[model samples]
Target: MKYFACFLPIISPEKSQQFRPQHLEYLEKGRNEGKIFANGKFADGSGGLVIYIAESSDEVVELARQDPYVSSGARGYEIHEWEMVTKAVIPK
Candidate 1:
């Protein structure tokens, strides 16, 4: 499995607001299914981003397509594959 990051731009705020409830529901389902690794919105509210792990880009794209926000034309999403070379963890 590979990890991909999806950036979503809210094109139609009104439409996005309308679809947000369903969108959140789908996100919860995706998270439960382990398709979503992590996700959040920008502090500025311009858009949002989601990190997902999937078998292929096609799968990621399909997931994005099914998002109500995107399907309803409330947002546009761009997907990018990520390559994590190294990581370090710090104890709090």
Candidate 2:
């Protein structure tokens, strides 16, 4: 199951500052666990997105709910499933 998680900031930058570290730590854990495939903030800094792989969209949402940004009310997120019809692979 692949999902796209789009996170929009809900609080001021100053308030969000307090949760950044924990949020990044949570992402790190997800990355290490292979649940997070890709993640980045928008160029305009409006928000960020994370690509997740899980059993279902519900599972992805549940995992995203644990993010400090979401848990602390600093950001709101939406999760959508992704279907890859084709992908390009780099040679090893």
| Cα lDDT, all candidates | 0.91, 0.78
lDDT of 1 by residue, 10-43 (tens): 9999998999999899889998998898789999
Candidate 1 residue 34 C-alpha distance from true site, Å: 0.3
Q: Residues 1-92, candidate 2, lDDT per residue (tens digit)?
A: 56565555556676468898998999899989988877888888787888887888778888888988887888888777777455788223
Show pairs that collide, candidate 1: none
**TM-score of each candidate structure, all chains considered together:** 0.90, 0.83
**Runs of candidate 1 exceeding 4 Å displacement:** 85-92
> Which candidate number would show the highest TM-score if scored against the true structure?
1
Model 2: pairs clashing at backbone N, Cα or C within 3 Å = none
